[model samples]
Target: MIDIPSMQRAGANAVKAIIDDVISEKLDVEKKFSSSKTAFRIADLGCSVGPNTFIAMQNIIDAVQQKYQSQGFASHMPEFQVFFNDHTSNDFNTLFASLPPERPYFATGVPGSFHGRLFPDFSLDFVHSSFALQWLSKVPEELLSKNSAAWNKGRVHYASAPDEVAQAYTVQFAKDITTFLEGRAKELVVGGLMVLNMPGIPNGNPHSSSVTGLSFDILGHCLVDMAKEGLISEVQVDSFNVPIYVASPKEMT
Candidate 1:
């Protein structure tokens, strides 16, 4: 049960630029809609429990409304239907309960991974995901195999692991990203817009220099310390690893 607000602040800050870019971009909403009666469908991928998701959706809606007003369609504002997506095991109940009574859009919960198809073909006009793609569908299988070249033992992520271990995570991330994009491509309309914001390391910078990587290392050390004190078994610490992979900008491209 991590503090959702505090955990999401960094990601929220990182994506502000991208969100602004989307808002400023020429969306041609009126032309995209053509008919005045079409409902604008927006999907927030990986929208975990919270107020952060609400804020993000609100920003997007407000920006779109501004665009509509500028285009002389203020009188015929289309209805908005927003889909909040996340893994099936996510605390959707808490998310629903926390919804503001004054919410302007019709919100629906879509439970599933974003790595695969979650919507009908050409049904979505906009898609947003923040700090969510960093999570792989699952940890690389080779990392868990003792005999594998990428075996990541006594460590959690590829931060300080061998090159092969890092490569394995990179390969998995690429695969997952490909799947995510391909799925979204099928779901979004021809002129649809998608905005994604995820943590990325600078080019040529060692993972250790990144805050996230350093934090993982510190957590690993803490776990080892706990094991040494017999509060937790060393074997347990050795077997556990986080499923997140922080990619570089080049890797993303």
Candidate 2:
């Protein structure tokens, strides 16, 4: 059976090429990095409980080490300190327990939402988040209001919903991502590099027309069917939402 870790690894692996390329070209190790023994801090925002996080972090460390070696600074390799961040409700104990026994970096857990500030200014040298940014800080308030045109009645997601519903999601995504970027800007040191891997649709494609949307539509139909059979309340279905937004390329820009 495919588990959450497997799924996370699959998604993260898909972006390995992008991560390597970005690190090789964009990361400035020579000028920005201190030759002293200060630890190189890294944060994995929205990192869920699992082995996949360790693998992804290790890949980053390996790439950075290669860069340092290529630039003739292998002997001056800085110590790595990794922060695993997630919502307060996440199972941090399990995440910590699952760390690789012989790992190189010192690991720490940070509990908080990524949309807000979670680190001191100019503290982090590298930031990484994979398959996580598509999540909104919260469900769009417009969807829960009965008087709003975007009220997500009989649906748990904006996929296949009216344009107003989709628009509400778009607005929330913009706000949440802006806050996230602002917080990260304050946290990263000068010339610091960040890698974000998110799921997105191509330009000109409606979210409802994508495979993920169709799946959500089916889920909504199932929930409505269950409501009709008196297995669940209509109110429950009406108030439910997945709080996930699949952005288009344009929306991301």
Candidate 1 Cα RMSD (Å): 2.0
lDDT of each: 0.84, 0.88
- Quote the lDDT for 224 in model 2: 100
TM-score of each: 0.92, 0.95
Which clashing pairs does model 2 show? none
**Candidate topping lDDT:** 2
Model 1 / residue 251 / CA error / Å:
1.7
- For residues 116-196, write the lDDT of model 1, one tens digit per residue: 899999999889987788899998899877789887766777787789988888889899999999999999987888988
Per-residue lDDT of 62 in model 1 = 81
Once model 2 is optimally superposed onto the true structure by TM-score, how far is the C-alpha of residue 242 displaced, in angstroms?
1.3
- Please report how far candidate 1 places residue 149 from its true position, in Å: 1.9
Question: Which residue runs of candidate 2 sit more than 4 Å off their true CA positions?
Answer: 1-4
